[model samples]
Target chain A: MATSADHAAPAILNEVNPPELPRAVLVENNRSFTWITDKICGIIEGKTPAWWWVCFIVACFVASFTVAGITYLVATGVGVWGHANPVNWAWDIVNFVFWIGIGHAGTLISAILCLLRQKWRTSINRAAEAMTIFAVVCAGIFPVFHVGRVWFAWYLFPIPNSNYVWQNFRSPLEWDVFAVSTYGTVSVLFWYVGLIPDLATLRDRFMAAGNKLRATIYGFFAMGWRGSNRHWSNYEMAYLILAGISTPLVLSVHTIVSFDFAVSLIPGWHTTIFPPYFVAGAIFSGFGMVLTLMLPLRAIYKLEDLITQYHIDCMCKITLATGTMVGYAYAMEFFIAWYGANPYEGFAFINRAFGPYAWAYWTMITCNVITPQFFWFKKVRQNTALVWILSIFVNVGMWFERFVIIVTSLARDFLPSSWGYYSPSIVEIFTFFGTFGVFSVLFLLFIRFLPIMPMAELKAVTPQADVHGGENHH
Target chain B: MAAQPHGLIATFETAPEVYHAAEKVRDAGYKFWDCITPFPIHGLDKAMGVKRSNVPKFSLTGGIIGFCTGMSMIWFMNAFDYPLVVGGKPYFSPMFAFPVSYELTILFCAFATIGGMFFLNRLPMHYHPVLKHDTIHRGMDDQFFIVIETRDPKFDAARTRALLEKAGGKDIKELEA
Candidate 1:
């Protein structure tokens, strides 16, 4: 072995001629980890005027007001918002299912995509995982808060109680408790485990004493990793196993969540196809949110090189695939309703398209189905501006998708005598805003504290990190 | 940053250098040193004669424990403790237990694997004999170096230095705490 002082030029270093890096890119100006890390920290803080702090500040305000609205709703009751005679659980259920469904894309990106050996996942998996956690937290708030007796929420879970009332295992709501809790727990674990190595890198590089401390803490959780072959072997295996676990979870969680609506005897709501349809829709919306979040951050952070057009292109493909599936599901549901020869089901389908919420129905079709077709074009998919706009449309479309499923089906149920129109009150609107606030605040905090990209995973795939030769996708 | 005399410490610029040097060192009848590299160099483990890990055995045991635990827990929860007729369904139906049981099997297997790995590797203590070695920190980046334990039978400070020098060691130093 060569001694430290007598070292040969490393293969990675020798491959590239010392390209003249821009002076403005402080990280490029230095080769040492110490210098590069300090620059990263500087970029994170307002030390450099390069950041769009104005947008972040405005986002913070929007998030805070959302919190205020939530507090107001919680202080009052569900009655403060919506929920009349027939449409008692409209926006709340829709939002709950919608957010939960959106969360699936994160775990799917991080775990399932990783298992499938999709290298592009490394670019956005961290952010997606963070989104998953935040989205679950958002999803959880609605269910608990919607119950009104938020304090007695534990009744959902089975416990040894004085009242011999055994929680019904047959109930889909009970299954939801198990599924959502498990999803949240495992996703958090997966996210944190994935973060360990990146945190250590951040710790080793940054000058901040707090960062150093955090890095140390993260290092401890990182299991004193030295990138040993022994460690990597097990770590890679564990990641594989986690991804395997999460793939089914991504499928099962939303299926069970959809069962919450489907288990009911309601006309349009109760359908055999709801499980698969909802799962597809969830992944679609979740990917849309991922793209929405990634595009802005990639621009703001100047991480275009790291995030690349390739990642957006891949994510757009998934969005299109899922969008088509959802559209197919829409057509299938209507066909099934017509074919079933059930009058109530047929009428429910008819009402959804031509009834009071027809605008919402058309919006869903346009945003989720019609607009996403543009993504099939390579040029349109590569265009960040177009992708961002499409992502926003997908989100709105999916929300209306949930709204149509929940409110439209319930408003005119089995009998026309009990049919009624449901509209969200100011409180419901405020509470919805508040949930966004909570989600945004959590996401902001996550970005500031954690590496938005999995540095270690990226390093594994980067050309410099490879020991055994493979073709570089870049 | 100065080498303390006991045996030779050499740092290679790249992984290939370390591999080449390992073959040379083995041929030269030096068997006392350890190689440190930024990332895994294939075949190094065989060259180093490190034993096969026992983590799998521990993981297998953990998995068995998990499988039984999952079955028993469900049996206890649904069958023994609270035997309520759910949906005209039979109590302790194994089919319904698939999801939770599947989850537990994975959870336990993972726990056991990690736990066994840690126990076998002697990790999380932040103290190691190798930390005292010079150039060890550089192993995280683009360097590949080996520290021959001076206490080994074939180790002689001077002889080791001569052999390493002849083997194209870039920077040879006697590392000490």
Candidate 2:
């Protein structure tokens, strides 16, 4: 009954108007669906490698420094860490800012990139988010201990007490308390929501392998995810909403962090540019840390096909872009200091460049500005060893930047007599250095027990996962 | 009816197979059914006739409550109760209260979104009949499944099996309750 004309298909237009450009495959080597699941889940299922033991032991040894430092300081007073008359806020503030800045890259990757539909983020978001949480843990110690009376740190929250004095809601420090706690809480939720499906996969794997205890443990956390389309319809919406809110949250966290300095009347710190500059530098330093951590991981896991050269290139490009923005901020800060004609501000900028702290300033400039420029070249980004080394420089540079900004401004203030050099004692140095151990210990435990990359997300990006068989995707 | 086999579950090897099968089943006028997949497949919601989630409404409501809480708490503390001015500024201004309110908005919104997702999905269910299939673990890995509940008026043992098999489903079987 059908007409012959209806059965005959129209002649295809062979003349292509717009040329199709090739995009790099997010997951290389044409990995199968099961391969992705097995690869990520295998990390937890397999025996802990020897290097993990070595790293754990070394981390524990280093972590002892923080324990010892805190113990000595608490037994004595905060005075043991070299907080004298002029420089009450020295290494503690610097280390706090540095670690917080390092936390930014993780949220930016997981939230901002996810919103932008950058599929390469799928391979790295899990580890990056974990890094964000751990870095926040490291950053928190400094502020709590810096309060001097660690027991009274609970006063930071808005709780009714006998003192009858409410917190100053107008204060930037109060804003910081709200911002940081919210950032931490929301990040944990986002990370946990993302982990549910992957955890279910782990639970099923363990159930199949006859590992009852592991299955039960994983199943408890998975919250009974059955991969139902009915559930996924809601689950995917939750993930999207989290990503939506998180983009603004990530930006606001750094802005509030910058407010800690900018709200103060300090000459170098009181710039309108601080918010954007700090956010950019945070992302730059964060990517640096990510590269530093992940390069070694990529090699150890042989995840070249999963991670791929394209992901590295994308990260390098973002580092380059953010680094340039930071450099522009530096130039603008100098320009404004001179252009504003404020003697105090001019002197602060001049002192930072040529005064006693010139060495630290130059170290920051060299590491932050010059180091990221190398990523502009194809050869540099492609060379993993070089990229990893540059990432270390980025970390060092960002740290020195915080040190320079804090010390140079406070060390050489308005009064000549009050201006004195501040150097951290051995106790301060050890406590700051010990944070790396805490971060590593937590991170190592994470990679050992949980899926390091998002298996469910990675499967979604592959060609075969496409319901249409992804014929045109190539 | 309660003790009878819970449903017939049809398993498929790939996304496309299951996706097409979902369309066929939906067109067949089955009311109580669902698709199971390792990860969310694009447009599968449309194939299965599922409505979009209403979690955003919960998030918006939560944000409004959080913002109001932040505004009132600051106003009561700084402006009404034991007002002590610091920095010579106004006793309470929305200008300064903005940051805390913004943070609360995000926090409450996130909590509501996640909580609503769980509530809507009826998660933490711990057990379901579809879970007891011999190779059901594959549903959380590479395999896909379409479950037709026995509660549906249109469900018949032989008819559902014939339809699933015709629709390219493999390993079609009834799930134990």
Candidate 3:
């Protein structure tokens, strides 16, 4: 059945002899460092308009001004913001909890899914990890800044002093300090470790002759990786171990954060369901953030083939699940408020839904409870335009959810004399804006420096990759 | 330096061809050859008569050690070193210990899975005789090929070439150690 044409050795290589170079192929036309960098420079200089960069800058501007407002509030007094006798905690606390909640999906995707060996993760994990780090950075900034005397924030930690007083480890706030700091450190490390291999690949692909200095710098960060089997062996092992470590941390960190509220005997704050409820909310908001970024990202990077419709579909499913969980938590809170027969608890839920801040309540329910249900339709989930719009709505909804919870319950308490409506002052507003700016700047830089997708991981999952088969495939 | 198996390296265009050839070779009573490919071809393991790997057993052992260590540490710390009533709850409450215990189990199990997988596969290794054979690199790309080691007792250069041709191999070539 075979002709000599089939029998003859191919021109590329004789059947008996092959080239020594690894099977690296050029992914795009004009595969040179100079060419790639020039293209990137062109994008920056408006030889090509990086629309995402423009939107990112606009977001940064808005976020920066809000942060400025926060700085002003800190300088003046907590009184400048919406704080009265009983409702001392307001927008600052709400935003603090909201941003922290928004950081969860990143950890879930990068750490949990990595352990699960979900191949689809290759497309988004890098960006998601970057998002995690930035979101956490944003989250960490709030708690520290919200306190009036930001300088003495270090007092939160337990350090030995002449007074011979030790920190009360029993306090949930103390637990929060430890949990958030540990979570941030581990998240950063997890992200950076995963970036090493991909960064090295970029260095090899893009390092220039004259730019050897920059190349060496990026290369050093890349850790002298040569993709040896010995390296991959240890690298993969370490990654798995880190993932294992992060999973419980993901669940615990938010739980401890929730304890900051749940431990208090305030009518609204005290609840057994706070821990799991907060986690579900955090994940729900976090997915909303991911969706906000994913749509434009795939287009900007020309990664439609890599990111695909499948990823968007999967993320929509998660958003819906977590959104429902959060909705359930809301219902459970209302039920417990009634069942406990605690007058203060009953008033807290009643006022939240029907009080002066009822608009925030309605907004939260509409955005979080009603909006995500649209994703149940396969067409809605797969439609990039619709997904993008809904994701934005989810973000606003999640933020409002926190706003409603913090303000409504605290503003109108059992003692009507102490009850007062609260609103964010100018300072509080600026600080929130500035944090968003910082997050955007960091993310834009990451996409430019690193391969937006994990190419090595992608290569591994490809059907033609050796490791996909049994280990002994010759 | 080693006694050579005089045999041809055969490349198949698809996975099924490799499977069929491996099956035929097993039926012909050749135990001195092995097939390698770019990807794991399903059912090729049975066709090649390769035994199941012991990676799972290693991971299980590792997981057990991790779980025990994790639980013991938490018990010793909360029950032994510092016993303070937490929220008026009893010491050694399983709920309080879950985080640390779960962490340990995961730590151990993951370590075992990765370590065992590598060890069982004899990996993290730098040397391979096939690396010297030029065409072997393609095994990671588009083609599937099998080699008869030089040390195999049935190796004969001319007869092996004829056998591979009869087995429907196209463009067979001699492989060197």
Ten contiguous residues minimizing lDDT sum, candidate 2 chain B:
B128-137
Q: For residues A248-313, write the lDDT of model 2, one tens digit per residue.
A: 998999999899999999889898999999999999999999999999999999999999999999
- After superposition, the stretches of candidate 3 with alpha carbons farther than 4 Å from their true spots are A1-63, A70-80, A207-210, A466-474, B1-177
DockQ list for all candidates: 0.22, 0.85, 0.05
A61-180, model 1: which lDDT tens digit per residue? 776765776677678766776789998888888889889988999998988888887878887898999999999998897888778867778887667677756565556777787788
Residue-wise C-alpha lDDT for candidate 3, range A373-463, written one tens digit per residue? 9999998987899999999999999999888877787777667878787877666676776777878877877666555665556555554
Ten contiguous residues minimizing lDDT sum, candidate 3 chain A: A24-33
* Cα-based TM-score, every candidate: 0.83, 0.96, 0.70
User: Highest lDDT among the candidates is held by which one?
Assistant: 2
State each candidate's chain A TM-score.
Answer: 0.87, 0.95, 0.86
Prediction 2 TM-score vs. true: 0.96
Better of 2 and 3 by lDDT: 2
DockQ of 3: 0.05
lDDT of 2 by residue, B42-152 (tens): 889999989889889988998898899899989998889869789799999999999999999999999999999999999988798877778878888899999999889
